[model samples]
Target: MMQQLFTNAKVFTGTGEDDFVSAFRIRDGVFDWVGDAADIDGQDAVDLGGRTVLPGLIDSHTHPALMAGTAAAAECFPPAVTSVDELVDVMRAHAATVTAEDAWILGRGFDDTKFPERRMPTAADLDRVSTDRPVLVWRCDAHSAVCNSKALEVAGITAATPDPVGARFERHSDGSPNGVLTEIAAVGDVAAFIPAPSRDEQIDALIALGDELASRGIVAVCDLLSSRLADPLTTFRAAAERGLRLRVALYPGWDPEQPLADLDDDDREGRIRIAGVKVVLDGAYSNRTAWVHEPYPDSCDHGLRLVADEDVRAAADWARRNGVQLAVHAMGDQALDRVVELFADEEPWLTGIPSVRIEHATIVSDEYVRRLRDARMSFGIATHTVFFFAEYDGYEKALRAEQVPDAYPIARLYAGVEALALSSDRPATAWSGADDVMLSVEAAVRRRTYNGIDFGPAAAITAAQALMLYTGRARMLSPLENVGEITAGFDASFAVLERDVFTVPAEEISEVRVAETWIRGERVFAR
Candidate 1:
């Protein structure tokens, strides 16, 4: 790339100190000079017209591979379809578009908690969409799904079928399958039967999604669980070969039943590389399946701890041998406690990066943070604000009154954890556009849910802190290198905003738009 100078703008360098700069010069896809415009010595520069610039954002934990694979599914997320009736209408409308009578009618992002009925959509409700063709709609968390009667039959699930270990097929009063599948095992049972899109189709979808991500000011992401597709690394690399620009670090899921493929040079080095393996330890909080220290209110259940300690150790061992990070999906306090205990005496990585990362660390306590820090192993956390922002109703019911204060305590985590990233577990979250960086920044600053439920400002963070979490702090958790800052010698990637996020009222942060997104000295997206 040729040398380029961008001037006349307020640049948030994400350096955490004296970060703002007025001008920067890029050469060969890396920043070479960053200082005041007057220091440019009369060099020709493209004036930004006083816009606000930020280092390219990084989403440390997301499922873009899942998003790409399910791009064709009908979107049933809320503020669009907030009722069972509305959900049915969406599936019905989508069904109309499928010319083949036998084609499956699929939908994603339905939150039963946000509905007026405040109940899960039943098989009968989805039957209204298509009694003949199979219909399956996933809950917003992606941990559960409710299918129509046809889908149930197609999956061969029945009253006699035993629930898989660590998963459940919710039943009716008569012991017949109610079409509700919980957790990965149950959801996968029906999902496996759905005809998967071809690899080429998935690559195309991925490239399209990459463009969409760039438009939102995100330049890199960790596909926390990339094995949702047939060949995640290859598929992502294929997309990259066809103009996909996002820097992706893929963590293919760890399954004992189906061992991950051995890594090669291609998998180990690239813009899209296999960073690690992920092992899910428990279910989500939204469905009250997260393994918690205490039972959920009005219930004797302490939720389910899906994986065995031995299995987690095995995953850690694998990661250790491979010299890659091991990401544990620990949503509840009990699960988080298990993580701290399991890795307390474990070996640390020779690499400077954290050896283990706790994903969705939903209910972190002061002691937990202390232990994680004191432990021999290096620890990182990739948590989300969108979870509470979109699924507050589910959390409202799942958490005790005392637990609310500590739930997703942003300020505490920022002050405590050395490696912390506020990410968007998109498509998994209840809200549409969950990956929008501005929305998450507003959530971290305001500490308010989508319905305006106040989680208290005591745990809130400043706008700069929020951006750092998404930028500089977030990059620490991912395998992507030379990103998340506008400092000299770093990748010349950043986003130009329409207004200064620091100057905006905290409540109005989400309204801040990305006017342009540049990557490697090239303007890839312009709004």
Candidate 2:
């Protein structure tokens, strides 16, 4: 490796607003000096042409394995497929290339809320794509899916088939299946029958996904649901050996009946490692399945609670015994309250980071924030702004008039909690560029949806503060050291930007692009 000095550039170390440096020195993949350009005048330095530089970003919560699996699927996301007719056309085009009569034709990222018809695509709509083969399209949330009639038959779902414990199959007037499967249980029934790709194909997909992430300036990520891939720990390790770009922390989904296999000694420390276990306590607010205290508008039904208290306790116990973090998916207030109550008396992790993380603390009240801080247990939250930015129509129907101001209160949480991160649950989100760090940052700064609806302007934070949610503030989400900063002894990883994000107009923050991305002091991507 070469020792290099980068000079004549604006660098934000991510510590605070005043933490800027004109130059930095990287020696053997770590920062050795980050100070004035005058101090290193004698040494040969690479001039940066006054470009703005930021620490390489960290996406605290994402689903890389799931994204990789669907890389080949037809993208039915908004702006491209805004109606049921458009969705069918995209799937049909994808189906045309597949010659196999028995192969499943797959599509993803269809949001009914954005459709002009305001309705989910039914089996009949998908039947136009193919009747001889299976056809399935996932709603953007990924919690539910709609399949063609042939797929329903393949999954053994019929008029007489009983709904699973926590899932449902939408039916028509005569009790025949409508081809809409709601929640994980119902989605899994059809998903299980879809043939698994070859191990080599899985590895290839992961590597390709890593490259895509690198190009977006993300150097690290926490795959919240690693179990989406078969034996994720081993598979990710193989991808790393084959030169995957990002450093990943895996959190395999926790199951009561089948616990994850014990981690190998080599799996404890490396480019890829198991960070913890994840257990989803409730569904998402977008689909009105978030288990909220109040029922949705004009409906008596509150959303579903997917797991039992005992099951959550079992997962907590597993994390405690193994000395790892336990990330709970609690999107609604009621579900968030349950987590606080259950762990109120527990002690903090000896490592001093959060022992328990509440994923998507979406509708947090001041009382909940106070309780989380005052509790004996150390708590962290991973939330998002993109949910509102991209899925505003869904929220419009789900939240009450009074509850609107409190949803994903970014500014409040930033002040109230020490361990808070704003992350994009990509591929699961409704937008095409859901993983774009700049897009999420812009949403946090502007506090406006894609259609220019302001949730609450007072809840917005500054551009720099929003960036911290993906940088220094986000470091606590993973155990990887020397990350999320440009300080001395930290990893020599950062992204050079075309323009300064801090000085740009509030709405133009998302327009800033990475000119170059470097990992471990080696330039991996350049535009």
Error of 1 at 179 (Å): 0.7
lDDT of 2: 0.87
- Candidate 2: regions farther than 4 A off: none
Alpha-carbon error at 441 in model 1, in Å? 0.4
Q: Count the backbone clashes (under 3 Å) in each candidate.
A: 0, 0
Error of 1 at 102 (Å): 4.8
The regions of model 1 sitting more than 4 angstroms off are none
Model 1 pairs in collision: none
Error of 2 at 485 (Å): 0.2
TM of each candidate vs. truth: 0.98, 0.98
TM-score of 2: 0.98
What are the RMSDs of all candidates, in order? 1.1, 1.2
